[model samples]
Target chain A: MTSVLKLMGMKSMNSKAAKTPLIPYLFWILLFVIAPIALILYYSLLDLNGNFTLANYAKFFTPIYLKMTFSSFWYAFLITLFTLIFAYPTAYLLTKTKHKKLWLMLIIIPSWINLLLKTYAFIGIFGLYGPINALIEVFGFNPKQILFTDFSFVFVAVYIFIPFMIIPIFNSLDKMNPSLVFAARDLGASAWTTFRRVVFPLTIDGVKAGIQVTFIPALSLFMITRLIAGNQVITLGTAIEQQFLVSQNWGMGSTIAVFLIVFMALTMLVTKQNSKGGRA
Target chain B: MRDLLQATVAIVIVCGLLFVAAGQMQSKGSTGSKDTLTVFNWGEFIDTDLIKKFEQETGINVIYETFDSNEAMLTKVQQGGSAYDIAVPSEYTVESMREDNLLIPLDHTLIPNLKNINDDFLNLPFDPNNEFSIPYFWGTVGIVYNPNLIEDHLTFETWDDLWDESLKRKVFLVDGSREVIGMGLNTIGESLNVKDDKVLRQATDKLMTLSPNVKAIIGDEITPLMINNEAAVALTWAGQAADMMAENEELNYAVPEEGSNLFFDNMVIPKTSKNIEGAHKFINFMLDQENAAQNADYVGYSTPNEAAWDIMDPEVIADERFYPSHELREKLEVYENLGLTWLGKYNEYFLEFKMNLN
Candidate 1:
């Protein structure tokens, strides 16, 4: 990434001092990115009162934390799956449209409004007296409570994650040459076969990118769980927030965060291999 | 699926904003002129008009910030990203701040109106002889229920009644580890400061039994839930219960006959403050007989200012249940500052209880 950035900088600047532009990015990496992670690691080894201790790490390995980790991963997997299932088709369809960029822009407009407002909107939309329940009651059935449930939790998460999933898939689909599909058809391949063997294989990178973006945040989602799920879900993010802010156990929060970091790295590693394997 | 693209754009925007906020915080450590006083208190705990009035009268610029909880407030002050002159924290937080040397002793000369405060609220266990803190407001943790929603056969008065079947999936707990776990302890007759896991486990197990009745555990949103009748019963503070009752006249608050928490919010000067003189002025301004009474009327919690009672809302003053008489207060518990270890344990159990909500 640095080499690519340097090459781009050298081309843009048309000078030997291309290295100057790299300084700010290097500083940002060192200060904002690297420093915070280093702090988390350092803090993880200390107890509540700043005394050195490894109890936090041991606590993370306990059954309770282990169970929470498992549940968090399960929810993240479900959210990623649903987001991809929904976003992939929409992105593919968008690429086929005449005003694809305008349509994409229009779709992206709602996300500009505050996320909290959007989340609260879902509260009313799924409320007992809300439109969904009203629709149900229209069918002559009683309105059911829909605000605080696992379904609402996943639904809201997928809603929030959809755009992240769609953009990458859309980009990849747009990049593909339309002649590939025609070539596959010329070989007597069915439409489904063309997509499966040619189009889908090419777009695997975008899908993997979508999964990468969706799953990591889904694992750490704390606020959505509290507001929509009514605290029924305990993501690792929620636990970390509880430990840090409520319990004042920075050590424990940082230890959990370190684990989250590891999990994120593992996820990145898993998603990254597909692109490499496809390229070769 | 189009929503997916919109959300991605939103995420990018939010990340950019977060970076900007971080940058601002780094450059925000310096306090403004002495005329500026930064006051940090709980969300919606103070009257805004009074803030404007104070600013006008004192010729001091009031920079007001609100925190959702005591822990969050303490963390902000401790982190020192911004300077806060005065903070309104609950009893135990004031106590902990004192222990941590995070507070400066109050100057009584600057706050002569402290003489108007009730004797009972003056010097509590948290701060000896009223040195480090001054009572801002005091209230109880109680069950606020709507009688119209309760089944004809169902009755509730004490903390145990929260477990009643008729209230199933209707109870909303205040989102506090100490408050929720303390209510569980109150049922089993354990102190709020349970030092050991054995009693805590008992409280946790009992709370699990009450899980069927718990609809949600929340913060500021709990009030709306109660007002909308979405939650038929809520475990909330006296002031918030009062707010809910005002909005929905049918709601009734009951401090369970079993011992309940008597939370006292106090004004403390954290070490992060650069404007101690301005802070003292603000505190005194808040404590003035007329100002205190007006605040009491607006904020709706039981006032610590004895002088405020004479001119405050007659009905509120008469409601002995909300503002407990001296004898009733004898049974009310003030939350003790359980050091980090025990506090962490309480939080752990409460997290478990929350995770078991569904």
Candidate 2:
């Protein structure tokens, strides 16, 4: 009986040991995420007239603000799709290579440079009188005006964010067992079938990670769009910046920020649910 | 094990978020005392030599910060946290700041160089009798265009030329609501600070028509666009006009025949200022003839100080862009402060206009 009691005590001690580390994790969430979000929610309910009102949120529903919010989401969605399409193949190829480290270094080098500097570099390369136009002129074509367009905005956005997509996909692809692909092929599956059946399923986690990384940034990217697109293309980021800077409407800015946080939370929830289902 | 890793990742992300929040809170807590003087002004607007001169003349060390726009400068000061010792607000903003009680009344005794200012800049509507602000640099807004880009000798006779189909995707304007809307108002022979809702709407609509032709709405500097020959014509300040013309001889500046907006950037003490003596000394040093001329040369803005104008090279004064003729001056109207109600209306229209540009 004493031995059995001792065994029970040991089991209890082990359980306590497992639970203690979670205290710091819960403490962090309470201190950081929950606190600021609570503050933002409180601030969002304030009115421009300095009274506590729901008018800020009401104002957000106006056609102009609604359009801006929708456009921001739509643009971010397009950027993620394009990033995945281009990055997946590159990342897959990198995983297959003997020189994987070299390829990974090349993918990451651009990210080491400042984002603003990279955006400005693209302006030098693609501006109306830039090298691209100069080259076109050399080829006897009229110089094209590509700068300050939506096309250029997306192009720059994708270029800057491609590595984000690649790193995760590459990580997952690298971790997958090489035997799985070979087994599928040995069962008379073609190369395409082997990839679709064996390889793609394993990389869903990476794809999910890539989407989260690329989408969040693209949603809030202000400077690149502002500098490259010249503020002609409006987003929730610029709108919030304007509220604070130009409008001096802190209440409105806070409201927009609160909405953005909620949208991000909703996206994470959906992503988490989808990932749990183990389906793309 | 999976749960442990998940918790660890969650903890890491939470820590990062906490760090950012803590940093923001710490910065707010550490905003310095009233004894420290913070001077907020435009980029390259003041002479650092003059600031150093002020510090030497008066034992007060001035903390100088800068913004690129009058709107940005006013917004920060209006928010009232990092109260500035002094701010260089443009004429219209002086009116706005005064309306908001953001400015402190100036003691004329502190600025003895008030005698050196051109009579034309004194007794303005923003601060009549120069009670609250002193004129720093004054100039008219107009067009700077490259002659080589156009087939004909294109004279910027009116703001109408900005909308010409021939100049589509070749025209650039300053990305400022007040400047852009003022241009439209000037074209229609209306005051820049028009109070009538009907008149303001007309100006907004007229501006919308030219939106498609606009290649870019640039900020204070258009040197990159003009230097690269990306834009053929730009609505620019006289200082930027002079700088652009200096770079390319083919570039020229002209005051439109319809009218132009006259602006005077003035130095004023904010209500929150601590080191008033240092601010005064800085203003005095800037007003000194040699110092003023040096600053004018550096920033490329036309100086309002008669003493500074006298010291400038004859050719510089003769440059039509730097010094407009009496006839052109007659066509220019000083920007008056639109009261709070009108200014609010202006902000609304401006926001709508910017939003619709997409």
Candidate 3:
């Protein structure tokens, strides 16, 4: 692609006098990314008539919406916490297992399916007449309603997002120098101590990266919450979709989007500082 | 230097091909022709064969596009560049579109087959006088219940049964603002279009009463549950209920005595349409009895074409889920576009209700 572009009178980057290759990317970012965000910010600050106003944000900060914001954060935090507990050990075992590549591939295979499809598959399995309920019934228990409940909501969220958490942790774990554990062991550290002090510290970067990816998306989760939790779960993403689609409140939708961007930025900053502290 | 010229020519050719491909994709009708009619509608709502047949018969190439929602369709048409010759929007959306003057007054002279529409479906408050739109497919918002499961709990007669505490966790409400809240309004004997704040509050409270019993607020996902007998009762559209009832013997549908939402999707020519004649041709073609019946059967939605009744199967005509009896028909109210302010209020209450669930 670069060769094709270069041949079409685009300046080659090899020459010292050549313009920075970042120019095209900068233009793209300006047009698609920055401009849309700028437009959203502009919309956020306006009423429906295109007049300047901050009432959109004020409307968003009402007690109900505030509750929605806190609930979104809480759900995201829980998803992040659950994914960390479930994925860290699984990723660690993945590194130890024979055919690690195959096992890693197997772990990632489900994510290759569409997110909607994955949620639907879980819905079928979690429904009252589903296989799990069928098995429970065979053993004499009444079939349970797993779906449209908090448990299934979090379960499906974790299922869809575990790969995102695992991949980053796996990358950091794989990159860890195995000799650090040996060094800690030779210094009379027990297996648990070695893991806690050396191995855990080493994987902190991956864990931070993992949390950054998983937690951010979880904050804005819409489809899974609706499908698995049956509109019983309302995250910020659902609110944004409703505003734009159902309510036709472009101003309010843009206002919520702007807040989400701030939330994501604050989260990234917190993780970035924590990782720096961990390394220190 | 020679290779550079050759490479530049290759790049130009590739760019030209991409430009051409994009142009073709955007234009529903073949390039720059008066013989093309562009149509926008819901995805899979129309059978492709019908479009092909229309194209073949008129030699007017059809450019077909689809939208998932009426809001998205309005947004596209409002943006003013796509130039769709026709769009099919739901009942409430047609009102908004007409009010905004986004649609053109149809020349009934061009579409004489407008007579095919059932008198009951005509002169709807949304497009009264049949000026801007023609009825496409119509259905009612009603209850689809499993007789086997609810035999002992409660009799399903009035909208009040949906709120029965004895059937807690066995009911599924359709995931829409208008349908769910409209049921509440109906149960309280208020008009479905009640915009009074006091009435709206009462309706919200009534909805809250049923909140504990709702297993899920769902859309198309209710179909599988209804068919599989996982849900005892689901408030769903007539089309969906009819389809599910066909598969599940024990399942029955009811248009409660209090009243329910009877909605229709209408075909309209947008103000920006470039092929008015072709648009009329397409609408007229679709209204033909045989064609209307074929499209209805294919799409599994009820048709408003009275002529279609002649060609349709007796079983479909007898299916009360799709065709309500005269008494039930009197109790059914067509959904009105509650305008923007009321729409926002409804959305707020609906969101609050959903949030209160957990």
- Candidate of highest TM-score: 1
**Candidate 3 CAPRI assessment class:** acceptable
Over B1-358, each residue of candidate 2 has an lDDT whose tens digit, in order, gives 6777788787788779999997785454345332356789888777688777766766556788999877688877767666577899998889888888888888778888878888887898778898889999888888989888874746888778777778877877787767788887887789886889899899888888887777766575377768678789998888778778777778888888888888889999887666676667667778888888888887888888888888888788887666777677877888776654465457666656666665
Report lDDT (CA) for all predictions: 0.87, 0.79, 0.84
The sequence of per-residue lDDT tens digits that candidate 1 reaches over residues A1-280 is 2433454456547754555544545555677877898899999999978999999999988878998999999999999999999999999999999999998988778768888998988888887778999899999999787888889999999999898899999999999999989999999999998888889888999998999989998999999888988887889999999898899898999999999988887787677736343442
* i-RMSD per candidate, Å: 10.3, 4.8, 4.0
Ranked candidates (lDDT, high to low): 1, 3, 2
Question: By descending TM-score, how would the candidates be arranged?
Answer: 1, 3, 2
TM-score of chain B taken alone, every candidate: 0.91, 0.85, 0.87
Model 2 has a clash total of 1
Clashing pairs for predicted structure model 2, backbone only: B157-B257
* Clash count of each predicted structure: 3, 1, 1
Which 10-residue window in model 3 chain B sums to the lowest lDDT? B25-34
What is the C-alpha lDDT profile of model 3 across A59-81, one tens digit per residue? Answer: 99898689899999998999999
| Model 2 alpha-carbon miss at residue A19, Å | 7.2
Model 1 chain A weakest lDDT span, ten residues long: A1-10
